[model samples]
Target: MNSLYWGEGGRFGPFDEQEDGWPNAGQVMRYFREKSNLSAETFALLYSKELEKAGKQNKRGQVTATWILNMEKQNLIPLDMERRRIIARLLHIPPVLLGLATLEAVTIQSRKKKPMGTLQKVTIDLAKHQKSIRDALHIHRTSSAKNLMQDVERDIWTLKDIEAQVRGDLLYQIQELLLSNFLLATRIMKDQRNYPAAYRSANEAVRVARQTQDNDLIATALYTRGCIKAEWARRGTVFNGMFQLDTGKMKSAAKDFQGVLQLEQETSIHPQLAGFTRLQLSRALAMLKLGPRDAKVAQALTMVDDAADAIDADPVEDFYIRALITGTLTGLHAGGYHLGRSETLNAAGLPGQALAELNQVRQLRQGKTYSGDETRYQAWFDLLMSETYMNLGDYPEATARAKNALVTFHQIHSPRNMASIKDIQSRLALSSYGTSIDVKELNDMLQEWYKPE
Candidate 1:
């Protein structure tokens, strides 16, 4: 077990010996080739073709079989982030799998300070607008969603103006719109259960980002796309096989995460956002059952841990981010424990710990008299606690938690949420564990409003 920090200069023998260490590009290349049923030569040719398709390579100069062999040897670690990203994308793998060094660790030979260019100045301005938009769309906003949406529309136009001075300004404008749409649409889609529309908006966001030629934008868009894709994948795609577990869409999601890995040098955005994106990628891989272990999982997990640690690093500066990151990591730990990531149920020690965090979230909400969506967030936490209990097979406790969610949903007039409670109730019924309320009472409630009039 060795340890290394991103800023500790050059390579470190590693982190904890238990840490999965660096992922070998050779292993990922081999996995994709075998899974696609292509021989070594054929795989390289196909992958090289794919890179060309993405406009990442000079079509006149083809990658040779010998060159592919050298990469597979795993001796030459990729020093260039761009090359690493291209390889990860071509191989249908996560970029974090490539093990590139961090920008924070890059030491400058001279101390000449370059003035912030127009592009940098414009980007900083865009970031300010982004922050303002985010603040306006705060979950605790007192204004109606319609009023908030009007403000969002105004900001979108403002984003277009700020982005207009840059090269490929139209594309940047579209990317900004897509980014805002991605966040708003995905949040609506998730809460409303409009998975198809959500996927469309998220994919559109990625498409716009790709057209913008900015790695940071591309990475952020991909990260957003990956999050939506993961949620959809877990629900399964009964209609379109294109979105199935093994399809390119999953790989696309992975590649987008890799995009983030590749653009590490251009991370002018907040470190907290970058870290959160990495976490989103980790969750995507987990849903795909392509965890960061075996040969290619280390990079993925490293990104996840580093991102969380980065948030933890500035406790005072990133207080909200730290709390959110801790809550997210705790949830992931509990999820992995339940989903067979480890054999020992209690080994993760996170099931109870996550509940404590949720309690904290609830207390934080209480401090400010939450209304509307904020109140729903509190109810959402309650529902998650119930689901966790169910995952732990604590039937009585799960029933109680679900009941609480049911009461809250009805009070809020949320039919969709009430339906989710019914779904949970159905699961409880399958186990033959009766709720504290009469079965007839529950049925009557479901039948009265949920049934079509």
Candidate 2:
């Protein structure tokens, strides 16, 4: 029952404990091979061939079997990130193994820094754009998303120009600048329901974060990526009228969310990031389209409960996060406990109690002036409420809410949600309510709104 985790703690049970208080990378490699019953010779040969096939050329020329044995015999840690990766991939070492960085880390390092970040050293002017990139993110609902994205993109280009001429810690600040701008771009794209563009922006944010090798920033990047993917999977997919989960994409999003949690266990994660990530992970797991009694459903419920508990215990007084994934999470979620009952019940296809949960949330929010975050939630709540009514075959209520959600999503330039509203239209189209005048009118409105430009 000894702890296996490292905070440079006492030696964990059954692990190869090095005197230097870190896992010996060389022994770890051997550990994986021996676990697989792979002899040194066979393991080395396989490693060599894999490297050759991948066209890897190390400083020691061709990696040989004898070289591998010698390294193991001497407990020589392979400082070369690539060689270690080839070994890890070939042998399938567990994560947290020393000498192994994520496969993404290698790609981030090898990819040349974008020339945009470089200045002709002599022309370096940090003052020109230093504050500009940071200011770009000071955005609110008053700004147009498209125009905001364009401005941010320009700011990113300028920041890159500033980055090229700096060295030392200014470079790190620029990296954060790049990460922040890219994340903002991802959000703007997702806000517009432009998932592909969001994906690209998220990818860049991850690369920059990895290049910095900062765990908290990396967690943030992964969280943002997971959220975008979740939205893309649920909203951007074409309507099949079945309301079936996009299992593959959903699972991918879950993996990304899970990766952030793994990083959390290994290192300190920002409280806000940790809280929001768990919320997103819970939504993904709950909606895995599994049976009610399935393991994922239980796991999903547990995650949300943990999130609520953490919020109550946390001391951070007044920061908020507007969380949305496939329109599953509500705004006003992060700094507080969002009752997961409604979300889970809705995902489980139990609309009755789910609607009640929504009513409860409404009561809690009843007297407050609708803040911007609440305004966002109101639009999404309209969609969720619409779906719940449709599930209960209450078309009039569903249509009214769907129409309301559609107008809000459209007004906010959220084409993704607007398009998802069609799923309601689709379900109603096949129902006995298919020929109702209100249904036809709703259909016509969607057609007109989504028509042409």
Candidate 3:
């Protein structure tokens, strides 16, 4: 390792003294200087070499030991952003350690591979470095699920401290990053079946979104909150004991979905947002309408139909959109085909038909899914199929499908889904099938998993 590349390029490596988040520029200066074990004068020699190598002619000609001294004491400096970049490169640290986007973000922006909406030149310049920082740092929930959570969680908390120093559009950008982190954490908790924790994380996202007045962001946060509630009502063992399908948490989820729609009606939302919101609403409604004759089921089907007609009507051709394939599952067509139709079929006492439809959907998903949504999509589908088989009194198939879903959840370190399916595991334990070989192995695996490390 180079002398400059200390702390794993930031607060995460050795020299892990107690810092709140990634270091500010002054702190970076101090950490790297001390780690080099060089006098400020000698450090200035390296700083000068870096500036000269970059062909950067510093105002006041060159940096001196006193300049380094002033910076270490947190005094503001001129040409700060550029000089910081030069110093970061000198120290062989990640640009992020200086609260800047990674070098990759700059390269991506230079190529214009991604657009940043309609920002004028000044705003573009202001946002250019920040354009993809959040995405670069954020881990997909199913990817790196077992590890990285603690590091990312700490980064999310550290962002608020970063937020206080900026103002105007840049501040909004930081807030958006904060909101995104909160949403990502919300997803993690929800996947873990920590509904209360998920709800709290989601509400923080909502607060950040509303503060920014970005309507689409606000809608996403609200919709995510609805998802947490709906998932909890469906899978939370404690909540299942307290609330039936028609009312309680399911209805609460319905209300939040309705609120998103209401917001959409008041604004011009993205077509995809409308599609996702309606499809999720359909799930809540289908769950609420347990009886065959219930009108809500029909209403739920209507929403699904509308989403299919609109969101899935066009064959996707956008380059970026076309390129993002998540394993073997892709767009709204699968969500509508599986969650919408299969869920309604199950709720309407058509478990056989639902199982058939689900199998068909699985076939559709095999070896052909969008890269972004594949794991989550597959995991949820497996869990739903398990529930449907349980309804049909196929305990073996139910246990098998449940185990399959558990495997994905386990891969992602999701205890919530594990717990949700644990109930089915327990019910299976009460039957003659409990003595079956596969069931016994699953029981043992789950026991080992739940044990404290």
Q: Top model by TM-score, which number?
A: 2
What lDDT does each candidate get?
0.48, 0.64, 0.62
Better of 1 and 3 by TM-score: 3
How does model 1 score by TM-score? 0.48
TM-score of 2: 0.63
lDDT (10s digit) by residue, model 2, range 1-453:
221221111111124445655456666677677778888778767876877777775557766677877787678856766767778778776444653332111111123443321211111233444344434333433233566677788878877765665544446656777787787788778777678999999989889889888887788788888888887777665645434457777788999989988987999775545666677787788788557887877777677666653443333322211221111122224322344456666676667877876776666643332345544456777887888888888999899998888887766666666666877898888998989988898888888776421
Candidate 2 regions off by >4 Å?
A: 1-144, 240-244, 312-341, 365-374
Q: Which pairs clash (backbone N, Cα, C closer than 3 Å) in model 2?
A: 117-160, 117-164, 118-164
lDDT of 3 at 217: 76
Point out where model 3 deviates above 4 Å: 1-141, 144-146, 239-246, 310-337, 365-373, 430-437, 451-453
Q: Where does the lowest 10-residue lDDT sum fall in candidate 3? A: 320-329
Error of 2 at 443 (Å): 1.5
TM-score of each: 0.48, 0.63, 0.61
Best by lDDT: 2
Give the lDDT of residue 45 in candidate 2.
75
> Candidate 3 lDDT (Cα, whole model)?
0.62
Error of 3 at 73 (Å): 41
